[model samples]
Target: MKQYKLDFNSPIGIIEIVGSDTEVYSIMFSEHDQIVNVPQKDTPQVIIDCQQQLHEYFIGKRHEFTFSYTFEGTSFQKEVWTALTSVAYGETATYKKIAASIGNEQAVRAVGSANGKNHLSIVIPCHRIIGSNGTLTGYAGGMWRKEWLLQHEKWNSKGIKK
Candidate 1:
């Protein structure tokens, strides 16, 4: 695995990407900010590609990212995150939608809990999930940052399937 940091604004302060040869393993905000365990290791190919794609995303030139990645989570949590990635940029999905998508319509609270526990941030796009009431709610990055991100996607992002 290869790990590197890129400075980014909002939720995750400095972003860290853990990569393999083919795709990113994880993209997390440097919030808890655990330092890279080994800086001497070669930069992983996945990390390199992910950063390039992310640059395009921040610049509003990209929408969907194609990468082979795996996340470790409960089967239920994994389901939630998986559905989150399907949510197009600038679009928001309610917790209710996430629960239903995963075939557990009554699991809204569980879905919300899992969303909070998501170690991967933007790559998983957990920030794109909101309350069924159509309000921003329960973002691990802080709701204010969530609002900023959604608004940024809504306003700045182009070349997307709108």
Candidate 2:
């Protein structure tokens, strides 16, 4: 399988997206030259496409991501990830809501775990999920970044609460 990489400067931070056969396999935050399995082909088509979409997202021109992705995890985890993808850009949902959305209302804890394991981050909009009390809760990318992301989107969106 061919591999590819692209970097995006987002409001939160720089994100690196790695693709294989046009399907995104990993998306992680990067600060410096990290050990990323770079693309063998310079400016691969997939990488370019990813970078363009990311740029649109950061500028608030896009709300949804359209790309094939392979998220490796348990069935339950996959369910959580699938649910997370439905979270619209610049919107927020609760862990309990996400848990309930997956038809496992009693699995909030498991939902949190699976959410923490979300690799696709913003594309999957994992930061859009919050706590049951409307508080900024768990986020793998740090709560400060989460608040910044949400506030950024909120500011641009005119606080529609979407």
> Where does candidate 2 stray beyond 4 Å?
33-42, 159-162
Top model number, lDDT: 2
The C-alpha local distance difference test score for the whole of candidate 1 amounts to 0.74
| Per-residue lDDT over 1-162 for candidate 1, one digit per residue giving the tens place of the 0 to 100 score | 434443333333556776556656677666645444333356555666667777777777677786667888898888888888989888999999989999999999999999998877777899999887788887776777788778878986654542
Count of residue pairs whose backbone atoms collide, per candidate: 0, 0
lDDT of 2 by residue, 1-162 (tens): 756777766666778888776688777787655444444556567666676777777776766777677889999999999998888666788999999998889999999999999888778788898999999887887889888889877776763332
Error of 1 at 25 (Å): 2.2
Q: Clashes in model 1: which pairs?
A: none
| Pairs clashing within candidate 2 | none
How does residue 87 of candidate 2 score in lDDT?
80
Assess each prediction's global lDDT (C-alpha) against the native: 0.74, 0.79
Worst 10 residues of 2 by lDDT: 32-41
